[model samples]
Target: MPPSAGVDRAPRAAWQAALRGAVLAVACLASTLAAAEGQPGTSIATSVASRPAPAQAAAQPAAIAQRIMVLERQGRARPQETAAEVDAEITRVAPFSAAHRELLTVQGLMLAEAADGAAAERSALALDDWHLHPGAQEAGLAAGAALLIRATFAAHGGHDLKRADALVQEALGRLPPEVSDLDRYRFVMVHGYIKDRAGQLEEAVRLHHQALALADQLGTPWRRAEARTALAYSYFGARQLERARQLSDEALALASEATDWVGLGRAHNTAGIVLDGLGDQDGQRFHFEQAIACAVRAGSKRDEARYLANMADFYLKKGEFRTALLHAQRALPLARELRDPDSELVALANIGFAHISMQHLPLGKRFVAQAIAIDEDRGALAGAASTWLELGGYLEQAGDLRGAVAAYHKHRKLMAGVLRADEQKAILAMQEQYDAEQRNRSLALPQREQQIKAEQLHRRDLQQLLWALAGGVSLLSFGVIVALLRRVRQANRLLSASNQVLRQHGERDPLTGLANRRAFQDEMKRRAADGMLCGTVYLIDVDHFKQINDHHGHAVGDAVLVEVAQRLRATLREDDLIVRWGGEEFLVLVQAMAGDHVDALAGRMLAALEGTPVAVQSRQVAVTASIGFATFPIGPASLPVPWERAVNLVDTAMYLAKAHGRNRAYGVRLRQAANDESLQAITGALEAAAQDGRVALTLLRTEGQAKPVEVAA
Candidate 1:
C-alpha cells in the first residue's frame, strides 16, 4: 500500500466533508449580511442578512462561498474560533463541492469532540469518492486530516487494527515535508500507533523510537509523552508487561505535567493491563477506574468504552460474574454507539462468559454464539477459534459429548491456520528487511571502494603500509566476530525446529504418535478458560482387548493396537487430536458436529481396520474390534466426571455392542447409578437413535406445532 493509503484515511474524509459545509455556509452568510447593512462583505452573518428580502435566502449560498474565498486570501482578517465552533461551521458546509469535499471533512474532524467520533466517522466516509490530483494542496490536506481523525477513532475501536493502519499510512504520505516539525512527529506517532494495532510489534517499536527522536529534537514534551504511550501499547501487545508498565508510568507522569486527559487515560489503561497480568487486582481495578474517569472528563466515549470492557474482563477473571456482566452490559451500548465492531465483540464475549460461569447455559450460549457469528462474518479466525473452545466446553458440561468433540476439532483447525498465517507474515517481513539492507549496501559499494583506494595511496611508504595492514587485520577480526554472530542465528533456527518437534510430542501419544490424555485435559482446560461454545467429548474403548491379549500373543495384540491407531489417525482431520487413554481405550476431541456423527466415526474406524490380518506363529489371524462411544450435552443427565464418565459410558456401550454381536459399534448413555447393564441398554438405544438423526437435531415444537426456520445462504 502507498503512504497516502495508510491508516486514518476514513476519519480524514469525514473532517473534509464537514469543513466544506462550514466554509460554504460562512461565505454565503457573509455576503448577504454585508449587503443588508450596506457594509463591505467581510463578516459572514451581516453580509448574508443584508440582502433584499426577496433575494436574502438566495444570497445565503453566495455569501458563504465568498467568505470561503476570502478566508483563502493571504491578508484576510479573521477572528479566532474554538475547535468546537470550527467543527460546527465545518458540518454546516459539508454538503457542497465534490473535489474538496474529502479535505474539508477531514479539516472539520480535526476540531470535533472525540466523543462524537462515530458521527464524525460517518461524515468522513461520505467523502470516500472524493479524489485529488497529484501535488494538489487541497488533496494532501484532506488526506492528512482524514488520517488524523481515523487514528483518534481507532484508539478505542477495539479490533480494527487493519483499518487503523491503512488510515495512518495515508495521512503520513499526504503530509508535506515543509510542515512544522511538531506536526511531523504527530504523524509519526500515529503511524506507530497503527503498527501496534497491526500486531507488528517490533515495527511499532521502531516507529515509536523514530517519533521520540523527532520529539527530542524539537524539545516537545507533549509529543514525546504521546510517543511513550504509543510505545507502551506496542510493548503490551508484545507481552512485555514490565516494559509496558514502566513506559506507561513515564507517560502518566508527563501527562500529569501537561494536563492531557486523553494521554492520562491511555496511560492508566496501559498500567491497568500490566498490573492485572501481575496479579495486582486492586491496583488494576483502581487504574481502570481512573482511566474511565479521565476518559469521561475528556468527553472521550471510545476510551470510556475501552476501560469498561477491560474492567468487565477483570471482573470475569475474579469470578465476579454479576459485576462482570454489569460492566460488559455497560460497555455494549457504548461500543455500538461508537460503531466499533471490535469493542462490540469483546463486550459481548465477556457477558457471555459471565453467564456461562453463572450456570445460565442457554443465555450464555446465545451471547457467545453471537460473538462467534460476528467474528466469523468478519473472517476473524482467531476469535472464532476462541469462541469454539468455550462453546465446546459448555456442550460437554450439558451432556452433549459428541457436539463438544466436534467443536473442539473445529477450533483446533482454525487456530492452526491462524498460527501459520502469522508465521508467514513474520517470514515475509524479515525478507523485506534483508532485501532493503542489501540494496543500501550495494548502492554504497562504489563510494566505499573509492575511499579505500584513496587511503591506500596516502599510505605509500612501507612502514605506513605495514601500519595500515595491522589496522586492516583488526577490522578483519571484527568482521569474524560479525560472521560468528550470523552463525549463532543460523544455529538458533535449527534449535527452534527441534523445540517445535518436542512441543508437538507433548500433545501426542508416545507409543502411537497419537494425541494423549494430557492433551485432551489441556484442551478442556483451555475451553473452560475461554468460556464460550458448548461441546461434547467421545470416550471410545475397544471391546475384549484384554481377552485378545490373553488369547493371542502379546506381539499380535500390540499389532492390533497399532493398526487401530493408524486407522483412527487416517479417519480424523489434522485438527482432531487423538490420544490413547490407556490399554484399549482412546479419546477423540472434535468440534462443531453432533452426536449423530459418532456412528459415522465408529464405522470409518472399523472399515479402515477391516481385512488386515496379523501374523502369529506363521499363521494369519483376523481380529474384529467392537467400539463403544459416549456423547455429552446430549444425554439425559449431565455427568459430573464429564471426561472420565464419557470414557466409562463409552466402555459400557462397547460391551453392549459385544453382547449384541461382536465387531459392532454402540453409543453410551446417562445412568442414575453405575449400573453397567443399564448403561449398555441405554447405549444400544442411543446407537439406534443415532441412525435416524434423532441424536443430532430434533424438530422443536413452537406453541403446539413443529416450527421450522430456513437458513439463509
Candidate 2:
C-alpha cells in the first residue's frame, strides 16, 4: 500500500521497533544481574564516603567533566544531533567501567525512549546494584545517572516516591566540588520531568525554569524546545491554561525549526487539550489533526493511536456517529495489536458508545460491561470511574433508575477520592519544602543579621501599627467580615451554577446544539429498559456530511449543524430526545411509541431536516437526513438479544435507508402483542379439542362479548 494511503498504519512499524529494542535492552540488563554483583566498588562509591561536599558543590558536577557535560547539556542540541544523542555518545567515551556502563545503559534507554516501562525497571535494578556496591569512586556520574533513572520510572508509573527521593539524595551526596555548570543543569532538567509527574508541580516549574536557563547558556535548540514543552505540560497538569498554551506554542515553533515532528505533535496535542477545556471545539479539532499528521510523519504508532482516539471522541461529541465508529474501529485493533491495555480499554468503551447511539442496546451494553470488567481487573481507578459513569447512563436508560443513581454517585465518590489524594500529596511535598527552607533560614540568620536587621525592623514596625487599632476598628471589622461572607456566598453560588452548566453542556454538541454521543447512549439505555413497555430507538445521519465539510469550510459546516439541530428539535415531540451521535449522525429515542409510530417519527424528522434551509456564509444550503429505527420486545427474532444489539439493528437499518436513497427513513419492527395472543389461543384450543374437552373453558372478552380460551387438560 502507498504510504499516504496507509498514513496511520506506517507509524505502527517504527513504534513497534522502538518498543522492542527497549524491551530487549532491558531484558539484557536484567539478565546481567550476576555480572553486576562482582564489580569492585568503582568511581561513584568512593566519592560519597568522603565528607559530603558544600551545598553549591553538591549541586554541580566537576569542571573536569566539561567534555561529557557539553554533550549532556541540552535535550535538542545538535552532535554537536541533539543533546540527548550527544549524551549517549559521551557515555561511550568517558567511562566504560562497570558502574558507568550500568549508568550508561539506563541513560541510553531513557534518551532513546522516555516512556519505555521495561527500560525504567532495568534502570532501577542497575541503580540498586550500584548501591549494593557503594564506595568512594562511584560518586559523580554514576550516582547522578541512578537518581535520574529512578525518578523517571516513578513519575511514569506513579510508583514509589520514597525510593525516588532516596535515590536523588544519594546522587546529591556525590556531586563533586569542581563539576561543570552545564552538567548540573542537565541533571536538574532530567529530575524535573519525574517531579512533575509525581505531582510536585511547583518544584517542576522551578526545575524547568532552571533547565531553560541552562539551555540558553548552551544555545541548544533541542534543549530549549524540550524544556518549553515540559513547562507547558507541567502547567497544563497544574491547570494553568494560559501559561501552558503560551509555552506549548513556543515549543512547537522551536520544534519546527529542528524538524522534531514528535515534539511538535506532543505540543499540538497538549495545546489542543487545553483549548478543549477553554471551550474551543474547532481549535481543539484542528490542533488534534495537526498532531495526528505530525505523529504520522514521525512514524509513531503510540502517538497515532492517541490522536485517533482523541479525534474519534471529538467526532462522537459532534454528533457524527458513523465517523466516530470508524475511528473507534480503527483504534481498537491497533490498541490490541500493540498490547496496550489502557488504549484497548478506551477503544472498547468507545465502540460500545457508538453502538448505543445506533440503538443497538444489547451489544452496546455488553461492550461497556467488558470495558468496565477490564478496568476493574487492572485496578485502574480512573478507568473504573469512567466506566461507572458510562454504566450509570446505561442503567438509567434501562429504567433501572435506582441502579443508575447509585452508579453515578459511586463514580463521583471515586473521582473525588482521586482528587483529594492528589491534593494531600501536593500539600505534604509543600510542607516538607517549607520546613526545609525554614531550617535553612534559621541556620543562616546569625550570619546575615547585620546586613538584613534594618529591613526586618522596618517590616516589624509596620506590622505592629496594623495590629494596634481598637474600638473604632470594631465597626469596620464587622462590616468587612459581612462583606467577605457575602462574597464567599456569591462565589459558592457561582461555582454551583457553573457545575450545573458543565453537566448540561456535557450532553450538548457545541457546534450543532444537538444532543451529543453521551446523550445518545443515555437515551438508548432508557429505551432498552422500556423494552417491556413502549419505546423506540432511531439512528439518523446527515446524507454526505463529509462532502459538505470538504466543500464548505468547517465554520459553514457548523452552521448547517446548528440548523439541523433546530429542525430536529422542532419536529420531535417534547418527550422525545434527539442526540448528535457525532459528525453527521444523530440518534432519536422516542418513548410511548409503537413500531409504526417510531417509523412515522423518523420520517417526519427526515422531512423536517430536508425541508429546512441551512444558511451558512450567506448561502442557503439544502441537505437531507437518513433515519433508521429499532423497537424493543420485538419478539425472539427482531428484538436485540442484548441491549447493544438493538443499537446495531437501528444502525444497520439507517444505512439501508441511505443505501436505498438519500433523505429516507428505514425501520425494523418487533412482532405485535396481538399476534402473540392469537397464536397462544389457537394452540390452546387445538390441545383442548384433541383431549376431548377435558380442559376447562373460560370466556374473557371486551364489552361482555365472549372470547373463548382453553386451559390445560
Per-residue lDDT of 1-713 in model 2, one digit per residue for the tens? Answer: 11101111112211211111100122333234212322233322223233223543432333223323222322211111232343433343324343354335335334333344665555545544554555534445655665656654443333455455566667667666765455566567656655664566666677777777876786655456666777776676555668878987897787677566666676677667666545567887888889778767755555666667776666666768678778777777776765555556666776776676666767876776676677567565665776776666545544555555555555655554454535644754555554344333333243443434443554455444444533346646766555545554554555456445545655666567767655554555675564232357777788766446534544556667778878888888887777777667877766645544654566567667766578776777788876766565454343233434445545644544444445666554433332434423322232222245422222111223223232231
lDDT of each: 0.54, 0.54
- Score candidate 1 by TM-score against the native: 0.46
Instruction: Provide TM-scores for the models.
Output: 0.46, 0.46
Looking at model 2, report the run of 10 residues with the lowest lDDT sum: 15-24
Clashes of 1: 97
Segments of candidate 1 deviating more than 4 angstroms: 1-179, 216-222, 390-406, 410-713
Superposed by TM-score, candidate 2 places the C-alpha of residue 657 at a distance from the truth, in angstroms, of: 39
